[model samples]
Target: MLFRLSVIIVVMIALVLSSTWSVNVQAQGGDEPEECVEFIQQVLTDLGTNCAGGDPFQGCASHPVITLDIDEEETDAYTDDYLGLWPIAEDALEPEERAELDPRDRFPLLPAAQVDASRFDLANEEWGIAKLKVSLPHYPVAADQVEDTVFLAVGARIEDTTTPSDAYFPAAPIDISTTAETALREAPRANADVLDTAPSGVALAVDGISPDGEWARVLFTTNRLGIWDLAWVPTSVLDPTVDTSDLPEVEQDSRVPWQEIFLHDGYEESDECSLAPPSLLLLIGPDEDTAVEFWTNELYVKVRGATLFMIPPSGNVLMAYVAAGVLLVDPDTTDEWVIPAGFWGYWCLSEPDFYGGRVPPEPDEERERVIVPCADGAEFVRRLPDDDMQAWLAALLNPLGEEVPDIVETSGIGGPTIDLSFNNSDAIDPVRDACELGQLPPDICDLYEFPS
Candidate 1:
């Protein structure tokens, strides 16, 4: 057809013009002839493929990882105004001189990382376009190398990550009773504006305790502001493990949200117990934030409120070898120990539910009160003595092939579930009628038993 003939004529004209331009540029001998040839070849290739399809240069430049050394001596050329690519001299030169030429002189050095180019020059074809900008990684900048104009390609893939070693211990829970009435204030001082009154037995998140052990920064949700806020409260109301004198000062403006506290829905403002669930009650252990000054390495159970410090025995040279393997701390420096997630190498205990069962029975409100029925498969918190705990720690650190003693069982808090039933029948006297009627038959008394 006539349309097919017209397309052939247009292609021939483009090739003729490219040939003419290439010969004139080669005669001048300014830049590399191959660069011009390659550019033309690429244009023809794109026209054959992309143009034949639809978009000419769709998604071509977005994937190559390119790096370049900045021409520091030519810093004057790279002002804020000249963000676009500039030309470099390509006259007859030695290898050293060629190295000195700026990379932008040969080809444009696009920065895809630091800047958002999705809707800018990359998307528009009015400007001389090669390929998609976002298809490639960010251009590298070597600020420490040559001070003169130097062209160097050194691309590196940088990934942002937070490892267990680099994780920070942001805040700890305040061990205060629900009955203790304390005011959370806007400032660290007593006369500051009162934000909210925290009732006792509700474990609140504490950022830092004051040096004198008189005040501490605690987080609370204020009804007045209708937002989560950090405020100061008296230290006397909190049950802490370490001396307040050792705690670092918390900057009033630099407070971050405690993730665990923000996600916790176990306790409300009116709850009697400090914890959210009865299952979590058994996880109550030592307060880790308070022990930072004395212990170098510690294992913290965030939800269970337990922290077990790794304190290896001294005086023996072999102890160091053992300590090195287990302890993630360095006593020489002031670095605090941080417990990673899912490290269940410590003793734990859970408080019994409201009705007396497998665990040490709950207190009787009155002698006249009737005993509640026990659930099908009741479980109690596995406890170990102080000596047993020390022995377990010693066995872990001991280089010698000592027989490991099974002292404490690991907690089943976050582990596999178990049904607390005896032959599929309720084991306790007060089987809540609601659970008894359920299809799965709730194991009200069963608990998770972690491996020791």
Candidate 2:
């Protein structure tokens, strides 16, 4: 709690220090915020911009990391405390020209990766330490096989707070609709279970599409079950007018790992942050039906083309499967409980300590940190509120270069989890009685009406 407060204090202080923090936009001749003014007035301190030691494509040198395909070889991009990332020009600019640069050019969202609230008084944002975000035409990986589908990364958009436990494929919105009555299925194939039948005009929101573009992952709230589900529906139902150009094509049988394994190596000495929470890596599979399995925090997990939020053992390890995704949380290695996306599942690694046992109260301040096993202190599963999910997604998709907040926690929302916690995985599935694999019975499924 204190850790979160401290970060808030840092930003509040920055906003307080900034003269034009409240200004709608910075107008020429108008007084800008101190942070913005200092960005240009003082030597650029952003780690991403400097040549000595900073993020990719240093302001004064050729590309140190991946060679960008951008028009400008060397571009100047810095972060300000108040305003997010400020991209000026490639070459040196005259003071007048610098002043002429529109303040709106700067991004508004900041990353949670390199959060430092203690020194909000510091000069620039991305203080030479923020993780680099870059676009790689062909990202080189350690392994040999690589394709455009790999999204093959060079740097950390999918990285996490602790070592090793990080990464996932990018996720785009699914606010598309159906032109005619659609059949939601259990899998991408025609023989799959018919989960539900939607009306002709029914609009649907889904995430990824099948590799062959024949299927889409759709979420539906069944009336019989009175629960939301993660199921597959044919792409043919999509409204012709809905623009799905932005949708990322799902890679069937993905070669990419949905998430990296946890090293079990605890936080470092320099990583102590009173209580600033570690960021959770929430992901939907890049593939279609095949489930991706991996090891982390002494637990084995299974997930198909579903949305799962994982905080590896390195940092208060939390594995939560949300809304319309299925995540298998198996600690004992037993036949895992199939945690239905009907209700979100939270598997705990640590009980009292939220941030992987870090930032416990002041009395335990001197205690040594260790990787808390998921079975030890974890409660297995808990329900997460809707607001928490929204805040997290916003940070992940922040247009300001994916501003991942170090702590994407919701405060003042009563609490993180409600009083209800699932006893077993079977208990978590709301439709098991009336529906099997989202296959609805005519007697129960057809009775209720869904929103358009």
Candidate 3:
């Protein structure tokens, strides 16, 4: 009995081993083992590879993780030096006056030497604080001692994630300037009101600046009436500049003039409605015949005396409509017929349902032509020719009307006749009005009009 039990146990063990081998074989063949290992490695790495020897499972052999220790003394000294040069005040100043102030006095300069491993926690796992570095030129206090000092500020938020068990790796450096500015603009601190208010109109045309200058200021005139703030930084700071040598150059027109206009349709205090005010109106032709007018409520453009177009700040769709019709020319392109009129209205007739038919059969010359019902019995049917026959028939017999032509029985000759009788209230006045105005029918227009 004991020998029999041993044999049974051995058989059971063999079966279990066979099952395990089959499972491993299936896994290896169905899914790549190397890819699975790689995915697992990535998941482990993301879950804080704080273990030793570059392996999270091991301790003491890995490279040491860096942590930040903000230098309060250095920061304070930098702030004082910067503020001493450009003192901020509660009163708002003009752009020209602000430009006259030294940039060194207004903005703190970042020290290249101070950038160290400890200054920036390279191994920080939190996305918010992982790559946090101090941005200089932060204005914490309003300097009452200086006049016309402009302050441009940026800030950073610190994050903390140094634990080995954490499930996130260090993030790349991110700029919170826009976010900081938004918050400051919306609700500024009591002492930081100067940063919130935009400078008044005072143009300062920036000639080129010295290579060593800390800041560059520029000014341009606007017809808009309101407080405006202009920040000047090198174009490289905003976006990467494209190399022009590879691109073909176009001829420049010295006499080509452009004008800026501030068009206002309505006034409201909400964030959506905040807009700058009017600028100087200008005329381009004889006796103000081709002139642009800017007022508080309306913006008017008169081309000679025959055509006058008024554009409200809101609901400006003339450009969009023209673009849809291909009537507006693209200033960049030399090709005149790039856009064709009525191109927007053209619809492809290949869609089966669009013509009220089943999927069309493969192209064959011997197949009998199919006749479909039109939505407007005679009028719609009459319009169908060439490729549009299917569409017109679909429209006519849309609801399986009783008068559907007998096309199904007659092959191509006749379909069930669709009812063409119109109710007394369905007179064609609305259609006439639409045709006269060069627009869709009144019922269709009402269906597609912009929501009020």
Q: Which candidate is the best by lDDT?
A: 2
- Give the per-residue Cα lDDT of candidate 1 at 254: 30
lDDT of each: 0.26, 0.34, 0.20
RMSD of each: 29.4, 16.4, 30.3
Candidate 1 least-lDDT 10 residues: 315-324
Task: Give the alpha carbon lDDT tens digit for every residue of 103-174 in model 1.
Answer: 112332322111011111111221111121111000111222111111110111111122222212232333
- What digit string (tens of lDDT, one per residue) describes model 3 on residues 1-452? 11111111122112211212111111122322444334322322322222111211111101112222223333333344432332333121122121121211111112211101111112231111011111111111122210111100001111111111111111111111111112112111223222222232322222222133322222222211111222332322211232212211111110001111221111111111111111111111111111111111111121110111112122221111001011112211242111111111111122322221223354222212121222223311222222233232233223222111112211234653322222221122222233334433343333223121
Model 3 is weakest, by summed lDDT over 10 consecutive residues, at 146-155
Whose TM-score is greatest here? 2
RMSD of 1: 29.4
Using TM-score as the yardstick, the better of models 1 and 3 is 1
Model 2, global lDDT: 0.34
Better of 1 and 2 by TM-score: 2
Per-prediction backbone clash count: 22, 5, 27
